[model samples]
Target: MSALLQLSKLIDALSERIGRWASWLVLAAVLISAINAVVRKAFNVSSNAYLEIQWYLFAAMFLLAAGYTMLRQEHVKIDVILHRFTKRTQIKIEIFGIVAFLFPLVLVVIDLSWPLVVKAWLTGEMSSNAGGLIRWPVYAMLPIGFALLGLQGISELIKRVAFLKGLIDDPTEKKLAKTAEEELAEAIRAAAEGAKK
Candidate 1:
């Protein structure tokens, strides 16, 4: 169990690093887009490559950060009814969901996409658009992303089981601070209330 916990920590670190790296793609995409727009409007010199690269970066960001999102417990959850249950029950349901749904879904996506990635790489597939980029790298993201997600899933399963076994604290508890949007919303509500008073 301790060995498995150590392995989970390693996986968690991998997901964290990859996710942080992937997050920079957002800034890169935005910069590219702004530059592309300026070049098109000012110089009337733009290529489909710029547009395609932005698209590719955005796709990569979403795909690569999936595991990171899962690790952070930020993925969408249908907790309206589930929240009524005890913590243990909630954790048990989560384990069941991860096993029954998450794992199988990841496996299927990787299985279906791996051949396509291989074919694209072998054929040297490029975008049909003039001045666009190669296709295989983006195609490869499916398996890579899902593999990362699967790894994170394994880590999460280990952590959750350890928690249940009284080996550690509750892994389901999110340790993050309030998001920027949440803070902003609170500020707005507070200002409104002050104004009313």
Candidate 2:
């Protein structure tokens, strides 16, 4: 159990690091899009490669951040009814969902996509669009992203089981940290109160 917990921590750390790095891709994509637009509009020059690279960056960010999202417990869930359940029941349901649904789904995606990734790489597949980027890098993200998601799912399962066995605290509890927007709003409120005083 201790070893399993350590494995869980490692997976969590990996997901966290990947997610943080992938987030930079969002800014990169935005900058690329802006530059593309500017070059197109101002210079009347455009390249399919630039446009395609933007899409690739977007896909990379979305796919790569999935495991991180799961690690952070930010994935979508219907908590309206779920919140009514006891903590143990909730954990049981999550375990069932991860084992029965999430794992299978990710496995199927990786299985289906692996061949495509390999084919793209072997063939050196290029985009059909003129001056477009190679296709394999984008194709590879499918399997890599899902594998990360699957690993995180396993880590989450281990944590949930550990919690049930009294080996750890509740794994589902949200960390009590303020978002940037929240912190800004709080600062504004404090400034306003100070002015009134």
* lDDT measured at residue 153 in model 1 versus the true structure, 0 to 100: 96
lDDT of 1 by residue, 25-71 (tens): 87689889999999999999999999999888988999998988888
Q: For model 2, how does the per-residue alpha-carbon lDDT over 36-117 read when each residue is reduced to its tens digit?
A: 9999999999999998999899889889989988988889998898889999999999999999999999999999999999
| lDDT, each prediction | 0.90, 0.91
lDDT accuracy of residue 193 in candidate 1: 100
Q: Itemize residue pairs with steric clashes in candidate 2.
A: none
